[model samples]
Target: MYDYVKGQVTRITPEYIALEVQNIGYQLFTPNPYAFRVNEQIQLVYVHMHVREDAHTLYGFTSLEQRELFRKLIQVSGIGPKGALAILASGAPTHVIQAIEMEDEAFLVKFPGVGKKTARQMILDLKGKLGTLMDVVELPSTEDELPLFGMNPYGHELEEAMLALIALGYSEKELAKVKPQLEEDEALTTTDAYMKQALKVLLKMK
Candidate 1:
């Protein structure tokens, strides 16, 4: 029922964002909730409203490109919204588009929930359709990497994060570029936090 909301970002939790639009707060679940800034202006969030027997949910994206990709992803036989979100969470839409186009089932299945059958189905279903969205895909490269961890960080945390990214389907080259940016932060610990940070970095690059 909603197209988009232009408002101030009042809150950001790990899973969702609260935007105050015209004195109302809209809770929006995104692929990565960290992508928004508190008090920043947002525009044109293409949305998907999911209604279940017990509840109603609204998911939002900054751009129609991401929403379109999300829509196509969930249409696959074995993929669901959560699974599709995880796939989108990786922040490398171009690689995903490429994987679909190239029929790279091996590569596509590396995401958190994707399997060989689902990957093949993604290719069969969305290969040619995602071409225009290729421009929106952002694979992090060396020169244009985003900051991952906090300032003055340790190498181990970044390394572990890289491992997690690899486990999440990022390539060595892509991880290498972002590693320095992540290493700059000293406060982070454990692979999970690193995974979160890594995803944030990857998404920003996108």
Candidate 2:
């Protein structure tokens, strides 16, 4: 029933972000949790409610097209919310649409959890239905709101931000690629700032 949640990101983890909207913190699972920074106020999370026998969860997205594709992905046989999210994490919805259109099962099967059967099912179910998604899906921009540096000698904020990034689905190897740049920048002082900087490096990282 909820359409969106506008709030600050108060917490981040490997699978979810806790967005505090009014007085309540909603746990929202997203494709790229690290794309957001902690405590940056006023973000709109386009949402979908996924209900199961034991619990209900909210899957959040940065844009309408992302949310719509997520919904569509779950409707296909053998594609659950988590599976759909892993596929979306590639940041290449256009490539996925093209693959489906082209019936390139190999490319589609390259995504995590997608196999030959699932790939063909996706093509069979969604060949021409994804044009609107392709036309509208664009990368959401991350705004670096603050710089966190030179505030403390111990670098606690940087440490915490690194842990948070690790929690936000970034591997240690991936963080190692950008850690030196962050270390060299003495301008980062807060976890949010470091998180923002880290996200910039990650989004640019191929």
Candidate 3:
């Protein structure tokens, strides 16, 4: 029902961000909630609404291209919304598109919950369909180093990053393997930074 939401980010949690508009808060589950900063200036978030008998959910993205890629992902067999979110959480939609186009099942299966069968199905279903999105897919920086920021004394940033990864279907066991490393990395001060580093570690573990 919502094409986009224009509002200030009033709150952010591991699972979702609350965009307050007209005295109401709309909870939007995104691939990366930390990508948005709380109390930031008003912005437009393109949204996709998924409705079921049990509940209605809204998945938000920074751009329409991201939303479109998400929509396409969910249509693939064996891939649900959460799985799609996990794929996007890598922050490398360009890489995903390249994998799909190249029929590289190895790259696609690296994401949590994606098996070899699902990977092949994704290629069979979406290979030629994603060409248009390639031009618009935002390529994330290839740098291994992320910008540093002031650390939260309570360690809420790292905790939130962990929770977001769990919500994306990563197991606690997998996170346990990386938590110490994340805590030890002084450069990861912001939740976004922690998330990026954690994802890199998790992908490497695969």
Best by lDDT: 3
lDDT, candidate 3, at 16: 89
What TM-score do all the candidates reach, one by one? 0.65, 0.67, 0.69
Question: How many residue pairs clash (N, CA or C atoms closer than 3 angstroms) in each of the candidate models, in the order given?
Answer: 4, 7, 0
The TM-score measured for candidate 1 stands at: 0.65
lDDT by residue (125-165, candidate 3, tens digit) is 99878867978644434432121223323265678788878
How well is each residue in 1-206 modelled by candidate 1, as lDDT tens digits?
77666778888765677888888988888876655667666555678888889979888887777887888888888888888777776534556776676676766765777778788788888877776787765545434423221333234334545765675699998777777766654445334466777778888887
Compute the lDDT for candidate 3: 0.79
Worst 10 residues of 2 by lDDT: 145-154
Rank list by TM-score: 3, 2, 1
RMSD of 2: 12.0
Superposition error at 194 for model 2 (Å):
18
lDDT of each: 0.69, 0.77, 0.79
Worst 10 residues of 1 by lDDT: 145-154
* Cα deviation of 119, candidate 3, in Å: 0.8
Alpha-carbon RMSD to native, per candidate? 10.8, 12.0, 10.1
